[model samples]
Target: MSVDPEIFAKVKEALIDALGVDDDEVTEEATMVGDLGAESIDFLDIVFKLEKSFDITIPREELFPDDILTNADYIADGKLTADGLAQLKERMQFVDLTKFEADPQVQNFGNLLTVRDLCSYVATKKA
Candidate 1:
């Protein structure tokens, strides 16, 4: 799926608002778990938020393993899965209710600006 800067911006903002993190720290290469302190439950919320915000269902194996969403070795490997491509099939549709549910991470969502999140955000938003 193609990248949409506008949608990426929204995801970035959503993460920043949710996580209470600074924008500069939320870079594409940043590690969401080790560097960002994302717990398993928090990661789950991130996954759900990603699906809701962008309207896509990430494959379970690719998105969640050991119950977390991270970028530990993604930059070197490109991507561990194709969830971004899946989300990219539909871009213009925004699921408003996804954001309002207030998942655990929603209270601390702002700082999850990893490459994977960016790709998923852009894909889902642009879908």
Candidate 2:
């Protein structure tokens, strides 16, 4: 899916400002955690910036979905069960989970959200 350039610019700006990353580093495919060096704390600032910039209320569950990750029934041996993956997929429609599906380790979930996914989310909110 092609992200709206305006949305992408705002998202890129938010990310750059929140994560203190160089402009060149915030590519569409860059993972928030892995590529942009965004820690969990940075998400708060990023979300706040996005909400302010776009005038949209962002529910925490829509982005984080921490409940699913912590649920005992959905996890086994540090990996997400089939049902858990399904739930995650349903919740995170903006995210591309194809690669994550191959290795559904719970730890890897944090690195799954990319810049493009974030832009898509903002576009949905604006719509």
Please report, in order, the local distance difference test score of every candidate based on alpha carbons.
0.49, 0.93
Please give, for residues 1-127, the per-residue lDDT of candidate 1 as tens digits. Answer: 4446766666666566656678887665565765666666666666677677777776544443322224333212333233432232232132222332233232232343355555654464345
lDDT of 1: 0.49
**Winning candidate number (lDDT):** 2
In Å, residue 116's CA in model 1 sits off its true spot by: 4.2
- Candidate 1 segments exceeding 4 Å error: 1-3, 67-127
Per-candidate count of clashing residue pairs (backbone under 3 Å):
15, 0
TM-score of 1: 0.47
lDDT for model 2: 0.93
Highest TM-score: give the candidate number.
Answer: 2
